[model samples]
Target: MAKTTTASKEGMAIRTKREIIKLLKQEGALDALQLAKLLGLTGMAVRQHLYNLQEERLVAFEEEARPMGRPAKMWRLTPEANRLFPDGHADLLVSMIESMREAFEEEGLEKMLEIRNRKQIIQYLSKAPSDLPLKEQLEALAHARTAEGYMAEVIDNVDGSYSFVEKHCPICEAAKVCSGLCSKELEMIQQVLGEDVDVERKSHMLTNSNRCVYSIKPKGSAVL
Candidate 1:
């Protein structure tokens, strides 16, 4: 039937998109021509699929300049695309948390969180320059957080403050069960940034938002 044919075509498109995502994840970035050659499809077909994926915000492209000729556009998976990949670590984290809770109870969980916070502070402090201005310190903190899979960014406010936005949380699965982990993270951020700045959670992923946002302001200053 005509309807059945249309449905089949749609299903094929979905399968093709999944294949493209998988390829990007495994091989990093590739051009449409490269992807077409690998999939045995025409360049036009691969490009069409890439277009759809881009509209969905799962894929992105960067222009890479070569020694000669026009720059080649390389396609890559965006942070949103990361959710499609299997999180093997999530299962391991949950298992570890359960074991700790069973062996040491609530106090054990608290201790684990405390140790994590202390270690995180030390790690971040080692990378964050103490002599930089407040804004630069926030930028350094954002870079460190991004390296740790938080996908964090620093946004400057007009009033001389910053907004720390984390578009992705790698430990969401663990945080669902152990929310104290999130609390410790906030405490660590405040402690590491110094005593003159205040950090407040403006938005949270646990409340169903897609990202977490922290409003950073100077102490004794008006809220941003």
Candidate 2:
């Protein structure tokens, strides 16, 4: 039937976009020509898919300067694209947290959260620049978080502060079961960024927002 054919075509489009996302995630970036070659499709076909992905804000492109000739266009997955991938074992994690809460009580949950926060801070600090300015350090933190599938970015505020925005939360499923997970994450960021900077959760996805935003400014400084 006509309806069945339309559904089939939509399914194919979904599968093709999945393939494109997989390629981009694995290879980091690729041009339309390279993607077409990988997909065994024409460059124009690949570009059409890329256009749709871009419109959805799932993919982004950049220009790479070549040694000779003009800059080549390269496509890659945006942080929002991370939502398409399977999470870092969300089901298993949520179950474990629930069990901990039921068996060991609230104090035990707090201890577990603290331990997890320490580990995350150590991991992020290992890659984040220690000698950079607060803003630069925040940028590095965003990069580290994005690499871990958080889909984070840094925005400069007009009031001489910066906003750290995470468009996607890979562990949202886990955080929903254990509220401590979210609070500890904010604590971890504060610890990693140092005492000189104050980090405030301006917006939270758990509280009905589409994304999480952290307002960062120097200690004892008012928003200008």
Candidate 3:
């Protein structure tokens, strides 16, 4: 077995911090209390770390104006802090992917590659029992992927069509590449559908970037 290098660990740590940084970027600002709650840590603990972050100019806090009460400070990323984070999927997706990566004790690179492997998807969904209807089967597939840290959602596109969207891609932003996550998603979808399905992606606005949406035409639905 090869010994893991220090750089690998550091990379994961940065990825983890970047994960937090991603959230800050999304919310645009958060007070120490909010950060503590979001991270499930005590306010003091978050404050301690943030103190150093402030020194490094990665974060800054300012007292907010309040009526009839002491002003509270809100924490937010500085311009420097923004530079430290990778521009990846929306913060939710980044956090989810990072959480899953840590939970599996796997390197982010390896985890992403494994998830993208076409065969793995086919094998997993193949385990679903055929007795379930297509919608139920699709939900099962989405839920399974969600368990793996992907924010997967299936939306009814109406007229008997379904839209499949993967709202996060951890590897995409890290590597500045697509990593074919969408392709793998489509593959699993086809396996579940058991036939050619009309699928297309829609134009999306921010607040949820890097999301993949596929419009599906389920079998035997007359509406186009």
lDDT over C-alpha atoms for residue 157 of model 1: 84
Clashes of each: 0, 0, 0
Model 3 agreement with the true structure over 144-179: per-residue lDDT tens digits: 766665556677755877776665433444333333
Query: Candidate 2 at residue 57, lDDT?
Result: 99
Q: Pairs clashing in candidate 2?
A: none
lDDT of each: 0.85, 0.86, 0.60
Candidate 2 per-residue C-alpha lDDT over 33-113 given as tens digits, one digit per residue, 9 for 90 to 100? 999999999999889999999999999899999899999889987767756765768889999988998999989999988
Once model 2 is optimally superposed onto the true structure by TM-score, how far is the C-alpha of residue 158 displaced, in angstroms?
1.3
| TM-score of model number 1 | 0.65
Best by lDDT: 2
- lDDT tens digits, residue span 65-164, model 1: 9799999889988767767744438778988998999999989999999998999889988888667887788889889987777767888888877898
Identify the runs in model 1 with alpha carbons over 4 angstroms from their true place.
Answer: 1-82, 85-88, 222-224
Q: For candidate 1, what is the lDDT?
A: 0.85
Candidate 2 residue-pair clash tally: 0
Clashing pairs for predicted structure model 1, backbone only: none
Q: TM-scores, in order shown?
A: 0.65, 0.64, 0.43
Whichever of 1 and 3 has more TM-score, that candidate is 1
